[model samples]
Target chain A: MVKLNEHDGSIISVQDVNFYYGASKALTDINMSFKKNQVTALIGPSGCGKSTLLRLLNRMNDLIDGTRVEGRVYFEGKNIYDPHVDPVDIRRKIGMVFQKPNPFPKSIFNNIIYGPTLSGAGSRSDLSALVEKSLKQSVLWDEVKDILNQSAMRLSGGQQQRLCIARALAMNPDILLMDEPTSALDPISTAKIEELIDELKKDYTIIIVTHNMQQAARVSDETGFFYLGKLIEYNQTAKIFTKPDLKQTEDYITGRFG
Target chain B: MEGTRHTSSQYEMELQDIKDNLIYLGVLTEKAIASAMDALLQRDTNQARKVIAADSEIDRLDMELEERCIRVLALRQPAAKDLRFITTAIKVNGHLERIGDMAVNIAEKAIILNAEPQLKPYIDLPRMAEIVRNMIRESLDSFVNEDLETAEKVALEEDEVDKLNEQIFRELLTFMLEDTRTITRATIIMQISKNLERVADHAKGVADMVIYLVTGKSVRHQY
Candidate 1:
């Protein structure tokens, strides 16, 4: 219920939000605000509503049957849950990367240009430039540049994840949501994805749901510890790991309990 | 509670082992200081030689304990309170080693003073050595228990040792001025007092690290 400092306009705000599936509630009253150009990490055990919360940010939860959401979610100073607002338009400003690297069964060039083409970006020259720019931004251009016309499924798992990121970037969204984006990759690929996230935070507001506490500590500016669908603590990453004010947070970060 | 309990119980056992070794070192240093003072006051050359010979074990243990601390820091990568404990152990281990060296200095001075006739009864010097010994013991205890209040109390007692040093310096100055014959013995007694003062200063340094370990704030120069 605490109002954070009104600095450079908050990119996303969740005010007293709660989500439910039929008669069962998945998230308690959750109040959080993420600043522009900053990365926030959500950490908790399995079934802790971290992914559900990320989906709520972009209204992806609306696709689930019997799901009900309460309270306001403000993006760019406008309430996204307003009755007049279209869910499709809300999705265009916020893009998502899932836990698995799910590239479509199409050419690599087609995958990166899919979103922009669907959004009605004009001209063949503009589309090609957008594809190149998105691929470069995701750090996948060099490896896939020569094989632009090859099937995306033919690329490696790590390359496919980066291609998924490029696809998201082609939409030209201001915010990015990654739900355990590197959980399936090897250590080297995880490192690459981590490096990409670090670089992407400079130009895009990022919210990541990660189970790895060390990753959260290394990459996030702010961290939220969730338990039983409720946020137990939220603070700076250094404070959360070293000298947290709440005992629950200290116990969790020190590996006391899940 | 489960995970912290596991790590802390392990830390507690290791800390206890370190405390036993440190206390063993403290007792050896205390005996050395006492015997060195006895040789000075009673003119016993045999006791002075024993004090000089006993310093080898203290030096050996100092190396052993320091090696253990380095190994733990490299292996465990301890954080927060555990990090503070390991760092304070290193500082305190150094302090105790220096105290052992100071005792050897006193023993060497006692041997020279024993060769000459007694100038005066060693009243304030033995008292200062006793205070220094107690400070070393209490500082180690403060570190073992993470007791901030006891650490602060030990820090405050440093002024008493400083005052005793000044008192010994003035008394020796008067003795040296009164007669040329008493100059050598008086200067040696002044050196012994200075060594004891340094021991107290090292003890205070250990206490300061304990305060930092418990509160996560440096109190080295704040008095």
Candidate 2:
């Protein structure tokens, strides 16, 4: 329900962002800002730079060899791309959930505490409370309350996705980057994850990349329409889906083009 | 923006069919208004009865178009311009169906007036009917083409129809005062003119919806 002009509370801003995979450019002069306590969905075709733009938020592109980025990505008041800024520290503050439900081979309780334990977050009693709170926030606690010691891989596909979300939640990040987080799950899980995304936005800024247009319309406060490595249009979700001014945005939303 | 077709040819064709049928329904209602007026002018009870019988077809088209809009909302999940057009179509469809009923109302009064001796010669009454009938046609034309200019023209003509309706009422009041026998027929003539005036209002409603369809901003009460 936030207006387009009310984004002065932006938590992260990407200014003049460009990405290249060795010789070929992937994203071209992209500019966007992620407001606090809101979900921004990036939607387009498979190679539209939507996913590439998402990974740039927390410097996930740093792991790739031939990928190079040229832009200033500001998180809070500081630029995360500064040479002194640690990518690992930046990633810890900006957690991510992948397309597949990639829980560790450990037990459910261990999966939830993997990140916090490495950071030496708390004592035994504190870790127990954090696990319960994170699982509850992800809406997976009731289903797995009695079986916290069970292996995460043994859970259903939907349950595993929720577990991955809980693992990210345990880190207590300011933002959560999700890359097609529900693409591998069935309809029931997708709905539950969507509900959680709505709830999660109350505390964290969420940036999601997805192929499903309806999901983008349903969960996002703002949406960016990407095409061929260009950010064609970015606006509030209601305006983008109801009365887009641009012809390309209308054509894409109305199923006029592939 | 013209002839910018959808990527999915089937979806584009389906949307076009819905729009075409909406205009077709508009045409049918315009014919109803003209026939009902003709029946009154010629004092032909058979023509009035035919207009009454054709009301069922208008009702049928209204239902079919509603179902098509609901189907598009559910299946196509349309967005942007298509979304505005579908919503506008539903509102305009309601206005046209109500206009058809108003025509029937006029026909029922026409049937009663035909049973009695003719009152004073109907001069402004037929003129009012012609203006209202043209309003219906123009409103539908604006909706089909998403023409803002035609929609604005239709909105402006509604004021003229209202003035004519008032003039007809003042002229009929003299007939009721002069003779008691003429009072009955004069009242019915007044009701027929009132129905024609209402038809103009419904046409204006269709025009307002067309403006909304073309430019997502509403112009309902501003005019």
Candidate 3:
């Protein structure tokens, strides 16, 4: 059993972590730390294990049979992978938004309250207040406040994604994990989400995986470059985009990579 | 390690074009300074006039290079080293153009001095021009090869040119005090020396930008 040491300024720390899918190894001895209230972007070409690493943060990989994670992933001084710890409780504290908007078939109001309601958040008045607060935090309050009862499927792709973000925020998690949250949306919508990311970071630590390099540069405070399941470089976003220390990082960001 | 081409060949070509044009501009300014000094030494007004006439070409190339840099910045949206390279190229282009203008300043002064009787056999001014020309060449070479040593050498050469400028100034001051008749020609020669010194400063400026491009750290105004 790993000791439950007190965490430093970082909210999450991954130490000597290796992940495997069946017999195929995915991530290798990865080490990183995420600070509180910062937007950290993970970027690279596809199949770099950036998405795998994001899912691993909240124990999202535990749902898949034969997928195994080795080493310690400490959240708030506790190793989340310990057998005694609950995976459901770890996930509740680290909510995720997917690449595509996946609102439930139900109305927007119910979508926000689904997780809290399952945990037995009773009373009609309490659920309604939670819905309004989450929607406003995701910057969707003005557009959808009047149409709270409407089906989520009617919203645009960008709105639907923000609605998903609101749904994630409904749990009042300390950390938000986003996997390519803006890739499916149009430019204007992408801009809005990027702006929301800038605003949300004041209250939440955001870790985003993005294929779009400009979006990573625009939205992230720090950036980590991943390649072939290995972490290449992690640095301040300005440093990563302007003058990375490693040649491999420079090659990838400058579009000179093989 | 030395030459990794951009995956976008067009981007590779765009960067190459900026580099080639900068060297061409460097060569033009070098020739202008050489011809203008030769015209003064040999008292040849025609060569001075030719140097003066070549100024328009330098101006045109400077504008063209700036436009290309801006286009690359907007269209390609380059990052990391490519971003540093483009920004450096823009600055180097401006320095080279200013060097060309200084060459023109030297040519105009040469025409004035050539009209008068020989100014003290034109010894130090020609040496200064030669050193300034070499500074321009080495600075641009440093940029093309991304060679830090060559850039540092250019900066040291700039110091040498400055020393030569001061020596020439003191020597000409004595000539002016000895005879009132030599004042006009000696003043023009002094103006030419000052212009050559400024040209060396501009070359040093190019070398400084090259340093920033290669290291991605600004060394400007620090020395």
Inter-residue clash pairs, candidate 3:
none
Over 4 Å off in model 3, which ranges? Answer: A1-8
Clashing residue pairs in candidate 2 (N, C-alpha, C atoms within 3 angstroms): A256-B7
After aligning candidate 3 to the native by TM-score, how far in Å is the CA of A55 from where it should be? Answer: 0.3
CA-lDDT, candidates in order: 0.83, 0.90, 0.90
Candidate 1's residue-wise lDDT over A23-117, tens digit each?
A: 98889999988887889999988888888999999999999999999998988677899999999888888999999999999999899878778
- In the order shown, the candidates' DockQ scores are 0.28, 0.69, 0.84
Between 2 and 3, whose DockQ is larger? Answer: 3
Poorly placed runs, candidate 2 (over 4 Å):
A1-8
**Candidate 1 on B59-141: residue-level lDDT in tens?**
89889888877776676555445556677777877887788788788878888887777888879987887788788878877
Candidate 1 chain A lowest-lDDT run of ten: A1-10
Candidate order by DockQ, decreasing, is: 3, 2, 1
lDDT per residue for candidate 2 within B1-223, as digits (tens), equals 2457888778888888888898899999999999999999999989999999999999999999999999999998888888998898899889989888988988898899899888878899999988999999999888877899999999899999999999999988988888788888888888888899989999999999888887888988886
Chain B TM-score, one value per candidate, order as shown? 0.89, 0.96, 0.96
Candidate 3 per-residue lDDT over residues B13-99, each given as its tens digit: 988888888889888888888888888788889998998999999999999999999999999998999898888889988998998
